[model samples]
Target: MPEHCAAFSCSNRRTIASRARGITFHKFPKDKDVRKKWEVALRREGFHASDTSVLCSHHFNQGDFDRTGQIVRLRDGVIPSVFSFPVHLQRLEKGRATSSSRRAEESLSVASQDSQEMATSSPQPQPNDVNISTLNVIS
Candidate 1:
């Protein structure tokens, strides 16, 4: 019987070695029971198993790994897409800023329209009667 390793470091070291060379190695335990245990551990740490191989911190640093190679486990227990926390947050922030700016622009447009209406409705003095008496008094 093959001995089972409980620590992830062993698998991680091997994964790193494989990734650094741009090659995949099947060093991880292949037994169903061993895989089940690993899967449980990975899930506990917010990881998901999909058709593609699972990667640890070591695999992430490798040259062969890219955004397309990453994975995220969704709330519905499905591995939906690639995982990049920084990228995700940046997109969210940008969207929020854009929405806020749009709202501000709309409000400004409405205010300008109201101001125009007020200006148009207000009474205007005739040119000949405009402020001559006030100017004389000031002089």
Candidate 2:
């Protein structure tokens, strides 16, 4: 059987054309956690990567590769991040990301307010006090 890409909707296979296009296949990581992350990134419901399962280079950012050697390799802990997910899956991912980012922004805002309140409440300049306004201006 011809080896094929395991990602959903991916038609890449090991062939001369694919090689010419710089498409390389990567095996699922041996570390269970990293492997699971790859599977989740695929967004295929209930999908589990078998030992022989592979994802194509098309599903990863160019930065994900380590090319110091003649052979290309995925950097340790790298998870495939690119995909052409269906509209419904894309919408779901966007919704989740939006909510998560909103929560993160809220947390950062609250922290900033707390820091400002603490700074204002201090009547005396601390020995360690550096001007935040000056830092902001320099930035």
Candidate 3:
């Protein structure tokens, strides 16, 4: 079992022997930009991720979980950002980065917030609305 979580200042260890029953590990996203977002949220030190670097379930929101208690299958372009670091942990987790890196993180955070707002503010589909494809075809 892994010793710790990969999220910034997260120390939660796997509690169960079974991989399916306990805290889960999620690999860094395949997309480079998305992967960078995770790294920025981590706010850690000397961290360079290779192909297999992972963040555990504790860092992700409950919505990211599946009914089986495993991380859900993510849709294309989805990214995880439901975590928060403690104040003390925040101090401990700070890592040095260039100004460009800082700007990148700030922009990422703002853009994510804006997108989330748009998603929630959008109207839900009406149940009564039906598409022509759903009706029986007349020959």
Candidate 4:
């Protein structure tokens, strides 16, 4: 039987797809001290792990995986410290944007199309849109 993730709200199980994707299930540390540390990291309340309990690879960092040879593996004594849990909320400001951001180039193209339609539709703003008070004050 495949082992399911022991993390709270995570049900990732070891399967063919996961193995193909190089995602493996991690068994809890055999040493009692290490196991205690792992429990602290997982931070699950009122959950006790059995001998067969495991955690999925999603909780681990990319650096924890060793891909030097043909097959990828976890480095020995590599405790999982880089758990993302769900996701990291980040600001998508102008200069802080990442390549993996949700913004697509398609939106920009659509905006350009709207701009072109506006150009062909009308060249001037409505009379009401102009600041008549400011203009009279300037005069």
Task: Rank the candidate models, highest lDDT first.
Answer: 2, 4, 3, 1
Better of 1 and 2 by TM-score: 2
Q: What is the lDDT of candidate 2?
A: 0.89
Q: What residue runs in model 1 are displaced by over 4 Å at the alpha carbon?
A: 1-97, 132-139
List, residue by residue over 1-139, the lDDT tens digit for candidate 1: 2222223333333344556764332223345565555465443355434433444333222443343535521122222122333432333344425878889988999999999999899977778876756775644
Mark the 10 consecutive residues where model 1 has the least summed lDDT: 73-82
State the displacement of the C-alpha of residue 26, model 2, in Å, after optimal TM-score superposition: 0.1
lDDT of each: 0.44, 0.89, 0.70, 0.75
- Which prediction has the highest TM-score against the true structure? 2
**Residue lDDT tens for model 3, 18-89:** 365666777788788988877777776667667867777766666765555444554455566766867764
- In candidate 3, residue 17 scores what lDDT? 56
Best by lDDT: 2
lDDT of 3 at 104: 89
RMSD (Cα, Å) for all candidates, in order, is 16.4, 10.2, 13.7, 14.9
Give the worst 10-residue stretch by lDDT in candidate 4: 87-96
lDDT of 2 by residue, 5-53 (tens): 9998999998888999999999999999999889889988999999889
Clashing pairs in 4: none
